[model samples]
Target: MATNILVTGASGFVGKNLSTFLQNKECKTNALSLRNENWKADFLKSVDAIIHLAGKAHDISNVSDSDEYYKINRDLTIELFNGFLNSDIKKFFYFSSVKAVADSVEGILTEDEVANPVTHYGKSKIEAERYILSQNLPEGKKVYIIRPCMIHGPGNKGNLNLLYKIVEKGLPWPLASFHNQRSFLGIDNLNYLIYEMLIKNDLQSGVYNFADDKALSTNELISTVNKALGKKAKLWKVSKGLIEKTAGLGDKLKLPLNSERLKKLTESYVVSNQKIKSALGIEKLPLSAEEGLIKTIKSFKKEK
Candidate 1:
């Protein structure tokens, strides 16, 4: 029998990429939007597994309503997870974020962390995680709440696109000297990990951190983008202090390049993949820091 896998947040970045990816694996997949309120419980009844990708993301501008944090991220997850628990599903995969663990960790992020999130978005996700872990799920049930870093892929229009626009315009990549090593979740790697979970039922059920085997500096990322576009890589050595001061003014003026975004652009966030890679029994997926990024940046050239 073909395994039925139901995915939520079908219209979003990861889902759109994963749908096309699974077809290459010959997996039977069905997708539904979270905004689809009329969707019935029967719609999920026969599915072998559920990958819940729907949630409210962190708003960097801090413009979201105070109450809305719980409404979508926390409340909707419990509602969906309860439905899955009661149904015939054996495996449930929920896409959580590393921010739920901490805004910044001392070293690579681990599942054992106490989970101290600084924002309402992270707080809501942590609440959902608490609810899911608290349940005494059935003996055969397996739940995986995966926390992934920034996911990038083709057709993705995000902060990456914004960066691409800056570089493409020959802006001389101003943050060349600002060294940072942030983890990136390639769509291929994330999809492959979830596929392994669907196939390997005997694997332990718990929270997992998903990311590329290697972490890349923001400067390395710019070089990759430049290579993909076949353009000259021109990066300027502007002082980090000056950048931060300018960022502060930008924040006050509501300019495009602000202090918080500057921090995000230059923060070092490295996630360890030891636990997950060992569980899956795979060396690594085919995505490299440069290779995956090249494809993503190449998409912008055609658009321009």
Candidate 2:
């Protein structure tokens, strides 16, 4: 039987892919926007599940206001969730980032860790998560708060795009000395998890962390991109002090290799997907981290 699904942020990278995937699975899908005034009356009664993906993303430029993050991410979510509670919706899937838990992960981040978001964007998401968890969900109603780390795929151009451009330009990776590992969620695997949550009757209402099974280093990521592009990798192991000084200068010159960018490039943010995998009764995701990244790199080449 085809399930009727309402997806917010349907035009976004994740939502666009998710909506298409749902339609391919023979599920009827509709998009709802927060800009509409009568969303509650219009969508609440019509869908079997609501996938809320619309929120103020973490702005890399740091230009967006703090209040704006709270208003859109936290306040809007509360309003929509309250409406969902009052309606006949069976499931609600909230797309929260792992940043909501920690700006920097010490080891493998799990659902059990105490959330201490650093940035305003992260704080706003945690606020929304708190609100959702605080609510007394009625019987037969399921709500999930998903925290995904560094989602990548064909249509999405995030930090991966910057890396892709650098690799395409044949620029030598200068920060090869910063040894670190980071987790990334492939859009295919993320789509698979969301679909599972939609169809599975056993997924309990709780927070789940989503990620690819394996964590990769920045060096490995560059190598993967090189392989995808059929180009030889050019990694330059510049001294840490020299790189730091250059990044300091770059910060003033508004260059790409700033302090923040360097941290993101080299930081080890290994998220644990064990809980979600166990809940879904799967040991591995459909796509590996490198495979998904390769697909994304291929898309970048196609664009050029």
By TM-score, the best candidate is 2
Candidate 1, position 284, lDDT: 77
Candidate 1 lDDT, tens digit per residue, 1-304? 2278888887788887787777678877898666778755446666788888988878978999957989989998898898877877888888889999899867778888899999999999999999999998998889999999888877775778877887788878999979889888878888888878788868888999998889988888888888888888888989988988899999999997898788888889998887899998888777876788888788767776
The TM-score, computed over Cα atoms with residue i paired to residue i, of candidate 2 is 0.96
lDDT of 1: 0.84
Q: List the residue pairs that clash in candidate 1.
A: none
- What's the distance in Å from true for residue 303, model 2? 1.0
Task: Name the best candidate (by lDDT).
Answer: 2
lDDT of 2 by residue, 164-190 (tens): 888999999988999999999999999
**C-alpha lDDT of all candidate models, in order:** 0.84, 0.91
Q: Each model's TM-score?
A: 0.93, 0.96
Q: Give the 10-residue window scoring lowest on summed lDDT in candidate 1.
A: 38-47
